[model samples]
Target: MKKIGLIVNPIAGMGGSVGLKGTDGGIYKKALKLGAKTVTPKRTKELLSYIKNRNEINLVVAPGKMGEAYVREFNIAFKLIGQVPEETSAEDTRRIIGEMLNGGIELLVFVGGDGTARDVYDAVGSKIPVVAVPSGVKVFSSVFAVSARAAAEIVDAFIEGTNLTEEEVLDIDENAFRDNRLASKLYGYLMVPNVKKLLQAGKEASSMGKSSVDSKGEIARYIVENMDKETLCLLGPGTTLKAITDDMGLPKTLLGVDAVYNNRLVGKDLNEKGILRLLKKYKSKKIIVTPIGGNGFIFGRGSKQFTPEVIRLVGRGNIIIVGAYGKVSKLDCLRVDTGDFEIDKLLSGHIKVIVGKKEEMVMEVRC
Candidate 1:
């Protein structure tokens, strides 16, 4: 029997509201602001149905939302190697990868977005062949399947000895993201190696990322409306945040994050440490960021401008998230990660990032 590893990023699409763009990490709050819904059980059910009768494949799955519950729903017995923590992060995904690698699964199937792909890349890299389900906002990479049912087709083909190809994995600019900048670095390619009868690995797929242009415009209007005195608004990348700068009719970096104060660019792509220097003048501050679709990472991958010190200086409560509906529903819920373990903890536990006035959103994080 061929071994396969399955993982589902449960909250992968929760950032599709308020124009934050992606919901992987920093933008889930925007999803809440825009009234987005989760795409969970339905997507899960689809996968379960396809794999229900397969016998040539041995399924090794991560527990709960990862695959266990869905497997049971389809009555497909699977080996449970690990359980996702009640508040699981991409860390859990990596842990599962370790297990899959140790067990030497032939193929890895991931469910989520670009951020999720990055996580998978970090864990498995080019060691094995992988195919992803396009369940996130912006799937900029080339390792994904065409559609939900299409994923099943790939699996079937792989089992039948189809050949897959190598794909390029992108390294995202997290620091620029907090300031509303978008610069993607091409890390390299991992060859999945075409199999004779296995399902053919797909090419780059479409993205659910909303145009941040209008959202940034709206945010700029809000900043202008509220920027009477000394409040500083730190901006992050993506079209949404760029909208704010655009509304001001100023050129903003689409790939890097920036800060807006008094209707002006204060800083650009400031990391956690960089924000420390800028924080000296601004007592009242606001940090803006887009969410990563699927992976739900708030800080590690994108929005590196809002560093731990910056978050502390600005206060997590003062952070504002932005996104549109298309970005949020990519994942069933929302997610966050700052890269720093202790900071992840400090930022965890019912943190309230500003989504809007009286129109705020909340997330339950495990730091």
Candidate 2:
């Protein structure tokens, strides 16, 4: 049997919607206390659902929520690799990867974000190529495939003898990130089955220079001038959208969803349920979101608070996308992986994104 290693970070993205930034260290407990749910199992199952040649491979997985729980739900049989603790850690990821490599697993598949990528690199280096499923709050690494289905495609190509190439393993300190500071570093690289548009580029930090700031100012001016007084505006996180509130002289959360009405900040740092509650109170609503710098993700990266139900309530036409020219130009296309196929479809296609003052461009939205 063709042996493949599968590992899942059970609490990878739990901190995102809860506005905790990441589940690294004891923050996972805080995320749980905030009612954050497991994200990787669902993503893992989505990746598994895309595999048509499952019978051709034997998966080696970690125990419990790490890997076995989702794998067990499927018909495919897998080998259990390690003993998992009730509370898993980065060391568990490192240890499980070592076990997977020692067992002669050909391809390594992990469901996680940047921190998980760092663990995989630390464990095995470039010994085996990896296919990463994007499932964390900080998916700023190039090692991951663009989406769950794309990861399955990469793995299938690997089994078919496709050539592997190096992809960057990038990560940031979660503690630093939660403090409103970005400190990204290149940990190493991972070999991956490379296919065009299948892999994502490493997250690029937005330019803090005058030119980028000027462009954001222009875009912010345009949005504020076009705002309707009767509409309740839900603003997603990022420096770009924060610029809007900055120009309006309103308080804005730099990393969490906030609400505005009548040119004033109404709600701050809202969760999914909090957003839903506002939607119920307001009859006219709109969602203003900006794309992640390098990934071009308008949803499913940091702003999981804009859940599918929230998007549906806001309606597709009511959603506004904004991006700086420097940021949007680096991306191949905009992406949205809302974890709901129907909702993704609702968001897919050409989207008009505001780039500057009275400047908009139509960009393709890929799922």
Candidate 3:
């Protein structure tokens, strides 16, 4: 059987719903105090559940909540690699992955986001191929699969014999991220199964070229012209969406959710609780969002504040998608991974995107 290793960063995505942006350093404790829950467990279980070639491989997993907790539920053969304390940290992730590598694992499957990807790159480098499950808040790295199910597929492909390719691992500054600045640099690369269709594209910085700027202005003008003054508009994060607020002469959180009512700034940098409170007060609500430039994700990437409940309350009909032609044209299709399969299914299908003034494109939304 092909030997595979599994590692889970238990505290990876605890900060997303609470508006902490990332769980790096000591921010995980703050996220816990704010009622953030463990996100990697469900993601690990989903990845294990969807792996069709379970019997064809043996798993070497880290002990406790880091890995063993979820693998025990499955019938696959696995062995514990290293011990971890009750409260796990990035050091635990790095140390355990090193042990797994020394144990001669042919491939590794890790569940977490950008930080976790960096840890894996530090441990594994280009030694063996890996399948990265996207479970963390800022999953901007191209090394990750689009979703857990996709990660499972990548694993099966690796076991079935696929070529390996190097994917980038990005280092994101959590402190700068919380302060409304996206500071990132290329940390390193990890070898992954070359299943191009299953992998996600790395986040591309917004273009500032003349054509791109003009396109954004046209989109902002068109949205403002057609906006309903009586509706409460929840604007998702992105410079493209921020252009709309700038056009209205209102401030916006560059990387956080904001609320607008009758062209007035009602809320800024809203968390899940804050968003729910606003949804309760207003009956007529609409959500304006722009997809990530390269990844084409409208939800479940940068803005986790737009939870499944929030999307349900806003309803599918009230969601407005806006992007510049330069960005939308490069994407194959739009995607959404709300962590709830029902909500993802609800969002999948054909949707209209406003690219410029009186210009719209019908794009398919894939779950």
lDDT of 3 at 324: 96
- Ranking of predictions according to TM-score: 3, 2, 1
Q: Relative to the unseen true structure, what is the C-alpha lDDT of residue 251 in candidate 1, on a scale of 0 to 100? A: 71
Cα shift from native, residue 88, model 3 (Å): 1.1
Among all candidates shown, the one with the greatest TM-score:
3
The 10 consecutive residues of candidate 2 with the worst lDDT sum are 173-182
Model 2 residue 279 CA deviation (Å) reads 1.4
The runs of at least 3 residues in candidate 2 whose Cα sits more than 4 Å from the true structure, single-residue gaps closed, are none
lDDT of 3 by residue, 1-367 (tens): 8999999999988898988899999999999999999899999999999999999989999999998999998989999888899998888998998999899999999999999999999999999999999989999999999999899999999999999999999999989999999989999999999999889999999998999988998899889988999999999999998999999999999999999999899999998999999999998999999999999999999999999999999999999999999999999999998788899999999999999898898999998
> Root-mean-square deviation of each candidate, in angstroms?
13.4, 1.4, 0.8
**On lDDT, who's better, 1 or 2?**
2
Looking at model 3, residue 304 earns an lDDT score of 93
Error of 2 at 260 (Å): 1.1
Candidate 2 lDDT over 34-61, as tens digits, reads: 8989888889999998987788899999
> Counting only residues 3 or more apart in sequence or on different chains, how many pairs clash (N, Cα, C under 3 Å) in candidate 3?
0
Model 1: worst 10 consecutive residues (lDDT sum): 197-206
Q: List the residue pairs that clash in candidate 2.
A: none
Q: What lDDT is obtained when candidate 3 is compared to the true structure? A: 0.93
Candidate 1 per-residue lDDT, tens place, 111-159, comes to 7767788888888877888767655544555565534455666777677
